[model samples]
Target: MRGTPLRGAIYGLLAAAIWGGMYVVSDVVLKVIPPFTLLTIRLILGAVVLLVIRWRTA
Candidate 1:
């Protein structure tokens, strides 16, 4: 995988898509929540999700 350029490109595209989706959702949610509050909630939820995934895989 280290030397595979296509695999890296795919990963990059996937990451961009995920972030793009997050931005669009956050944009819509901004009407009901303040920017700081939204950001805080997103950070906490993202951390929890990553931790859960790590725990499960480990």
Candidate 2:
């Protein structure tokens, strides 16, 4: 029970960090890749991650 809050807080911080860094990373990446190409790559990567998580859980 005591570990639950700490785990949640850690997850929250990680989420925040990724969310914050995304804009900066995207800005730099966009200089090299086209906007649509980047968007497509992000979408594909997100889908693959989600699928892997689901597969592992199942």
Candidate 3:
């Protein structure tokens, strides 16, 4: 697929939404977990979700 400008903008907005939600969730998780570790877990989860999407599409 071509990396069209509009496609990039849409993806960027989606990523921003994910990050915005992460900030709020991380704030709540802060009560129980350290920030760095919480971020690590979030990263891992995000990676898994992306991988699953790729797998299904491919």
Clash tally, candidates in order: 0, 0, 0
Q: Residue pairs in steric clash, candidate 1?
A: none
Using TM-score as the measure, which candidate wins? Answer: 2
Off by over 4 Å in 1: 1-24
Question: Candidates' TM-scores?
Answer: 0.55, 0.85, 0.56
How many clashing pairs in candidate 3?
0
Cα lDDT tens digits, model 1, 1-58, are 3569888899999999998898788778998899999889889998999999999999
**Lowest lDDT 10-mer window, candidate 3?**
19-28
Clashing pairs for model 2 are: none
lDDT of 2 at 9: 94
Q: Per-residue CA lDDT of candidate 2, range 1-58, in tens? A: 5579889999999999999999999889999999999889989999999999999999
For each candidate, the alpha-carbon lDDT, in order, equals 0.90, 0.95, 0.91
The per-residue C-alpha lDDT of model 1 at residue 44 equals: 100
Question: Where is model 3 more than 4 Å wrong at Cα?
Answer: 1-24
Ranking according to lDDT, highest score first? 2, 3, 1
